[model samples]
Target: MKVTRTRLTEDEKKAWRQFCQASHASESEMLKMMIRKVSGSVSHTSARNAEPKSEKVTVRLAPGDFKKMDGRAQEEGYLSRTSWTTAVVLAALYREPVLTNEEVNALRQSCRELGAIGRNLNQVARALNIEFREGDRIKREAIEDLAERIEEHRALVFELLNKNMNRWRQ
Candidate 1:
């Protein structure tokens, strides 16, 4: 192993210690992640997918503890305890939420609705283009209504994102 050292001001050292504690990550792990990020060797998505699982870890919990964990997992919308544990671990490592199943479904539905609205807008634009070519008047109210619906959907998407992000906040 190669060793590298850097000096930090007292304030910087304090901040680093606090960050490591809050993230539930070892200093070595945090330093490795920072190095990868700074060197442009890893991106958020790539880092998450970089490792494939080929190992298993088994844990033995007391019956009461296991029941509590199972209940918490279900409450968080995880289909299984394993999935919930994975999400919690990844969230700590990456400092981001591993979205719940319900969150994923909600986002999927929103995207589908947005796609339909986009298709409708395209059809309206095509009709307007033809009208313009033939000197026919276009309906202003129809365009305005479509724009309003788009805005509403955009807001809903943002709201969902914010809610999901907050769900994992410590």
Candidate 2:
């Protein structure tokens, strides 16, 4: 055996700690196994089953459905539909709540609406603060309308969060 030394950044140190806790192995043992795997010096298998993979599954879908699935996966920042589908299926199997496409769309729309309302609110505030006294009454009425819209958007955000929270508990 040979001694090796290296430096790790703060983030790497944090990840190392997490890996150690999850893998239930000491640093030296884990590093040795990793080196062996990287160097192609060892083959891994379940202690009960030394045989390698032998099974595979294929899924079929309509072209349109596949396109939609791919679009949704990308919208959710997943690399591929397969990974997204796997995560959804695993969550379902574990009795965990996963958002449907409709729910995700609704959340996205709510975020956009809230952002627009906030911008309108800021514009109204700026208009009201301006020194031009000629349109004070009109600006006040517009501010009132914007305030009402902001409240409505806030309510929509709260409702969406409440609905998702309720669903997550199931």
Candidate 3:
């Protein structure tokens, strides 16, 4: 069997030993289990009934630590610690931003508003087309008003996206 080595900080070493002792698993066994778990290859059932693509990892935390982590997660605008942890892990893995709950909601709302503005613009264009087809005079004021509204919404969305990007850059 091939052997692998890793350098761990003092605290991490202590934590690893404690974890192994508490779980009654040898250090090598624990390490292999962690590798399998992270790789999503751990199976608890027979091959016929096992789900090969998905696995669950049960993390045992002390009550105090759980409460603290939950509070910290909520303070960061996450509904739960699990979601916050998942976002953090994924962001780290992908080198992407971990958006807070508020940021996500704001983005969703902005997209919806943008869609509404687009629909309104399409309607106005259709109306203008029909008026032109009928040889009726088009209202300049209506076109100008729609133009201004679209510009305002476009600016707002750009501002929102820029703000989010800046936050991630920092």
Candidate 4:
């Protein structure tokens, strides 16, 4: 029998112990199962040997964007942006419908923008409510304009969703 020693954070160690307990498997057995799951037909040793060299890549992100990524990485158990980014890239590569980081960022930005628009519409609705209490005839025109804008936004959202439906299905 061969032994492998690797260091893990206390949280990881606790999680591993819990997993082993739940599965009623020894730690070594669980490790072997994990290796098998990732390796498939390839020998773990051979796969490690065949792995490509890691290359340094530089990326520039806005401060706010970097902070968002850092927070997300921590939540997802990644210690650094590089690791998180690499995992995302690798996962996307294996997925049926791969989207570039730029595309994903654009989608996120669109969602934020849409949310802002929705909030503005809600504020307008509140104002319309107040205007209604005052018996203002101008409230009718404002309501129609607001409804038209909402419909336009809804249609745009549906179009975007429809275009990406096939990609999401996979």
Candidate 5:
């Protein structure tokens, strides 16, 4: 890191020392005030989106459901049925545990709904005679989202880093 140093006059030095002392206490008070201000804003925007996934599987569908799920997975975009099912469950299920039970159930229902969606979607894909591996579908979706965010942030960060690199070189 590059930092600049400067000499201060006697009057300025005394003021600077007082400012430093006051800022130390002021920083704490400022932080407390900001925390209070932001505590309300700490919304469940993305964090409280869904509930944490739990194993307690007191409910498992029949083998026929698996078969249907497999077919649906094939239609959606998966190669291996088992892996596809696991991915489906994981993707639609997991979230922060601190959320409410209603929120958790909502997420769970979404998982069930996704399975039904896959079934219906696969039927459509089948009618269209399209064969997409579930793995590829999931991967393609992930890469697309990642590429978008990376491209966005990289553009903003590149100039800052480039300037620092040049300063060091000089």
Candidate 6:
């Protein structure tokens, strides 16, 4: 084995020793023991990290409702209720997310293109004597259609975004 110098805090050193003794048997059994122990505990430790990430949280559901949701989350493979809900809440909070300067400009360009498309679609709708529904209008089935369109455009968007992601030197 190639030896490399590294530093560990006292607590880390003690934890390592205890973890080795309780689970790993000895340092020679890397693949057979330590891997499994670390894999098991890492998830729980990560699950606990979800708490400090949230600010204002409310559990407004009736007594059993939250439990049901937690059960559903667990069934869907999350570690814990706090972890799952924190993720949902954070995602909701950052739904639109932030963009860099270039991204803001790119979004402006995309808006222009989309506006042009919307205008053309509106003209088509008018010619066909059909009501024009805004493409962004929310509908139950529209999510699926929007997802399909997104999948279709993903490669093109990724390429375009990657190319435009850089700074435009003034």
- Largest lDDT belongs to which candidate? 1
Q: Report, for every candidate in turn, its global Cα lDDT versus the true structure.
A: 0.70, 0.63, 0.65, 0.60, 0.46, 0.49
1-170, model 1: which lDDT tens digit per residue?
Answer: 56678999997887676555444445666787778778987544423244694567688999998998899888877645776777777776887656764666676778888888888878777888778764344447567777888888889878877775665564
lDDT of 4 by residue, 1-170 (tens): 46789999997887677555433345775687677777784543432234585576788999998998898666644434665676566555665322333334445556776787678777776877777665465556666776777677677656554543443233
- TM-score: model 5 vs. ground truth: 0.20
Cα lDDT tens digits, model 3, 1-170, are: 56889999997887677555433345776677677778898554332233354555578999998997788677766644766666656665777555664665566677787788678767777888777764334446566776787787678767765664454333
For every candidate structure, what is the RMSD over all alpha carbons to the true structure, in angstroms?
14.3, 11.3, 16.2, 15.0, 27.2, 19.2
lDDT of 2 by residue, 1-170 (tens): 35878899997876675554334345665676677778998654322243464455577899998897788677754544655676555555776434444455576677788788778777776776774684688677877887788788778767765664454233
Per-residue lDDT for 1-170 in model 6, tens only?
Answer: 33434588997766555444333134334333344486764422332243575466677888798887877556534444654565455445655322333344455556666566556555554544543454334333455554565554555556555543321111
Residue-pair clashes per candidate: 0, 0, 0, 0, 5, 0
Superposed Cα deviation of residue 55, candidate 3 (Å): 9.5
Error of 1 at 155 (Å): 2.4
Query: What alpha-carbon RMSD in Å does predicted model 2 have with respect to the real structure?
Result: 11.3
Give TM-scores for every candidate, taking all chains together and pairing residue i with residue i.
0.52, 0.37, 0.41, 0.31, 0.20, 0.27
Please give the lDDT score for candidate 4: 0.60
Off by over 4 Å in 5: 1-97, 130-170
C-alpha lDDT of residue 9 in model 1:
100
The residue ranges of model 4 lying beyond 4 angstroms of the native Cα positions read 1-99, 132-138, 166-170
TM-score for model 1?
A: 0.52
**For residues 40-141, what per-residue lDDT tens digits would candidate 5 score against the true structure?**
655222211245843543337799987877676565444345434454444445521221222333444555655665565555556445545465675556
The segments of candidate 3 whose C-alpha lies over 4 angstroms from its true place after superposition are 1-72, 132-144, 155-170
Candidate 1: which stretches are off by over 4 Å?
1-69, 133-139
